[model samples]
Target: MDLLRSLPLGLYLEQPVTWLHRLDPRVKMAWLMSILVTPILASPEWRFFLVLLLLVLTLSARVPLRVWRQQMGWLLLLSGLVLLLTMVMPDGLVVAQQPRLPSPAEISQLTEPFETLPPLPQPTGYQYVIYDRWPITITQRSLELGIRISTLLFTLIYGTNLFLLTTAPEEITAALEDVMAPLRWFKLPVTEIALTVTLALRFIPLVLEEVQNLVRSVQTRAINWKKLGFRGSAQVWLQVVERLLENLLMRAEQIAAAMAVRGFTSPDEHKVEWHRFVLRAWDWFALGLLAVFWWARLVWGGEA
Candidate 1:
């Protein structure tokens, strides 16, 4: 019933800060974008390599087993299921057609018998149908599609999860603001946008807390579901939802009032630096490695 602990999707891990936590958020953001974007139109081998790379990063970082097990285990299982299902499904290669010319029987009857030309020497040993049996058939196209889909699914989810796991909400907003600094030239309110993001990230835990409290309160009331029919249960949940919204609005109001009391009129007037953005030696090293990553991707990751 503890939603916060059970579903730690965007929450940060504060204890036992790993090397991943120490790396500059900007570098991490760049790496995250690379992981997400590099798989497009890439070969299946490259896609699978991306998945393996994520696993290696997680292991090398020494993320707590409890944390990653919960995050990655189900994700891996789901991706594997997708791979299997995709492989078994039809790959749209099968087609039936009528021959334009005569069949072999008719040709033989029409022409004089001649020694069958020796079968043309086989060239490459490539087979379109990878596996065929009674109930299952796998084609090269199907296998490729399966690998593409499953690896993309795993990479998309786990890459973002890893970033959020190590980086704090403030750090995330700061990184985003830094990255978006160039947009300010077009009269964009970059500071305001960053402040909004900061507040939104901070509000996530509050939303979760409100939900947990409401659910706990409902459970403690010991409402008799047997006595109250389905309609009654629905009405009770509706009331809970209404109260949750009211509480959230009140929380927002309180935050605004607190800001007003602190004389925070505008983001430009009062800026709070969350984390000083600096590229340490390790961060520079990471950026260099990222460049190398893209180089290899361009050189060999393209689809045949």
Candidate 2:
């Protein structure tokens, strides 16, 4: 049930009101962007450093341990799964080819291997028999590449999760709108887009809650799953999903109706009241730290 409740990634922690939660949304946005962009073209070592940096930030934010435990568990599981798959799956070099049973000539050549001649040009690629049957060659380069890719993915996702954990939907939309405000000069519908994003973010948690409600509702009925069989159980789940979608649609319509009643018909008439983002000394200090991150990325980012 707790895992189900944590389905929505965009949930904001409202209580505790940590410093990260209180940071100016626009500044937070800047920090997010800086962290997000700096990792591109970075080596595995740099990405690992970024992962550590995220850990340090998460610790400093003072968000409750329980709040992030499930997330961290999922992240670790996901990362391990990815790494395991990478290790097990051979690289592109191991493409399928017609099976090559030892030919008479090859067998004869092998049987006559008494000559300790200078090592023949290293075979184009390694081919060693595994279990004296299946042949496989593991390449160091391929393994390193896979590990690097997995680490990169884990670091990027965990950092984004940290941002979503701390920031509110309204703050996210406002920060985006503020950052993209200059685009209005080009006659872009920035306000409308931002508002649309805001509504979408606002509904994410509600949709997750609706899912939980549907699950609980089904559970409360005490359906005998052992009696229903696999097909019946799947059908029951499908019906539940169908109802959930219908409820979501109905909820969306109600919201639309309410907005219409409140005169939210036109983007021009709709005004967004932004939570004022006053830059203080801490904000500057944060920016300075970001600058240092950029400098570090530029200088030592090539080492893996």
TM-score winner among the candidates? 1
Candidate 1 accuracy as lDDT: 0.93
For candidate 2, lDDT tens digit of each residue in 1-304?
Answer: 4644556454578888899987777777787777777767777778778878888988998888888878877887888788766655666664777756655577678856444458668756664322232453445655666667777777778878888888888888888888899999999999899999989987876787888889889989999999999999999999999999999999999999999999887766878586776788888888888888788889998655
Q: TM-score for all predictions?
A: 0.91, 0.79
lDDT of each candidate versus the true structure? 0.93, 0.79
Please identify model 2 stretches exceeding 4 Å from their true place: 1-5, 95-138, 224-235
Which window of 10 residues has the lowest lDDT sum in candidate 1?
110-119
Residue-level lDDT tens digits of model 1 in 1-304? 3788899466688977999999999999999999999999898889989999999998999988988897787999999999999999999966998889767788789757656677887699999999999689999989999998999999999999999999999999999999999999999999899999999988988999999999999999999998999999999999999999999999999999999999999999999997999899999999999999999899999988
Q: Per the 3 Å backbone cut-off, how many clashing residue pairs does candidate 2 have?
A: 0
TM-score of candidate 2 to 2 decimals:
0.79
Please give the RMSD of candidate 2 to the true structure: 5.1
